[model samples]
Target: MSMVRAPWRGVKTPGVLRRAPAMVAFCAGLAVLLAGCATAAPSGAGQVADQGFVSGDGSVRTWDPGDRDGPVRVTGTAFDGQEIDTDDWDAEVLVLNTWYAACPPCRAEAPDLAAVAEQLEPDGVRFLGINTEDEAPTAQAFERTFTVPYPSIGDRSGRVVAELNGVVPLQAVPTTVVVDKDGMVAARVIGQIERSTLESLVEDVLAEEEPTGDGS
Candidate 1:
């Protein structure tokens, strides 16, 4: 896996190393092996035995309704051989996560994600996963192991990641994108998300009023 250094231009993480060079080094070290030239970035270098857990820097980027870009177009096959697309998520808040079975941070945060999904789904929030490096069977096993309530798209073909391109710049595994009901990306957590952090972001999105038809 190869790593590229670049300044992440969004919200900033306070206290921790926030300089571009430091962030670049952070991205370089955590790159994961995947098919083609794709490399998944971990949240950081922190790790435990068998669990590459990296605590997130707690950087949250929230965009105003008018500042949101166009809805991201994503389509792929789920691990269960079901076709999935972002278009089907119309009029609902959706959470998109990038992860793989072997990613330590991904493993560590699986339960938190599942817990939040359960709490938010009834409120019209949806959760989707993008398994960056796993095949259907492996990805399915990971979900079962974690008891993840959401279905993940197996991105072995790399098409899904390619599609994400400018939409999210997918710099790290365990990155979370929270889209509002109108399909606008309302917020993003660029690393492993805590339950409280994710929950608070979703609540903020839910509280946003729908776009007014009148030019505001």
Candidate 2:
């Protein structure tokens, strides 16, 4: 019997396969470098997102009336176990903030947020808090410490964040989103929001004309 030579004896390893890991690592590094160099665009009559936070820059942004998205749908149980939903805020200005007591920025901006809530109450504006990483007791304690006038929804399940997908990215611990009277997303302040800046955003939303019968 004649022995047949192996057909695959002369095959060589491809260069790409040999260098695959290094090439993949180089591509990942390049992606990070490009992201770091990217500049954020300004929106809504010069509202700009400045330097982001240390965890990540939560850039601020505002949308024009025509560019605003439809009302966000959100609902959850408050830290005190009370039911809360965005339906109650229809046709009214609303502010929603994501926070956790342990976050420094969240702690730093609590007082300001509380103050803003107090100041805007008379204007019929409503505020809601989303505690993304805290239990009821911790959230309640933080509310007590900051004298918060609004009820915060316990978002440990991430339900609220999921509902706010298109409206707010919720990337930062202390992100704030302002909804116009029409229930549309009017503005967002990423990271720790300042008292004056938040106030201005609310005022801008409140100043917008009420939606006509067509929901303009």
Candidate 3:
């Protein structure tokens, strides 16, 4: 809950896409949550919400080191036609975000994510996007508008989503998964994330000692 402004926090939103949803986006109780989520996303969220993807509450979740899953397996070409294979990345931490061109929360959080990627990429923390929808032009337009600094895989086939099923519930368009050095999911933000919250999550993982392979 750090209120510290990210260096790029002042970035402006486009006039046409400026409708931000409630920050308390998701209902907490499972007893009534599903019913509540049926409503349309924020006006700017996307025209596709009517087609049935649910928006998530900005809830954060994490796994203990002992219970993590994967050295995740997946790969695909990015919007710019760059072939990215996670297996080949020499990063200590990997941040994977599931997004699309027009999700409201996605647009709202873009600047925060851009700043986080800028601040962390140089330190070996890799940020990748698995765009759940959108053609390269729409996705690239979003990236250009937001000044996003990382490459995103064009996951139009849902191939990457299938590959990462248990590690992430990617049905939510703006979900973000933070993977540890061993490629196991360390934390997740189930909706749009606050910059400080994301920074803290990545910093927490970045601070951990590489797991000792002593079979303890």
| Candidate topping TM-score | 3
Task: For model 3, state the Cα shift of residue 82 in Å.
Answer: 0.6
Which tens-of-lDDT digit does each residue in 1-216 have in candidate 2?
A: 001011223333222224767457544543332223212233332232354323434467999988876556567678777777667664468898888777776887889999989988988899999777777888899999999999988765444554464344555467789988767788887666778889988887787754547756
lDDT of 1 by residue, 55-132 (tens): 345457889988885465556667887777766764368888888888766777789999999988878888889887
Please report, in order, the local distance difference test score of every candidate based on alpha carbons: 0.67, 0.67, 0.69
Tell me how candidate 2 scores on lDDT: 0.67
Q: Model 1, residue 121: displacement in angstroms?
A: 0.9
Q: List the residue pairs that clash in candidate 3.
A: 26-57, 45-104
As a whole number from 0 to 100, the lDDT of residue 180 in candidate 1 is: 80
lDDT of 3 by residue, 1-216 (tens): 001011223333222122334112211222132222322233443333453545455677899889776667457788898878777888989998877776777788889999999999877899998776689899999999999999998765454554464355544557789989987889987667889989999999988955568887
Ranking by lDDT: 3, 2, 1
Weakest 10 consecutive residues of candidate 1 by summed lDDT: 1-10
Error of 1 at 203 (Å): 1.0
Where in model 1 is the C-alpha error above 4 Å? 1-58, 210-216
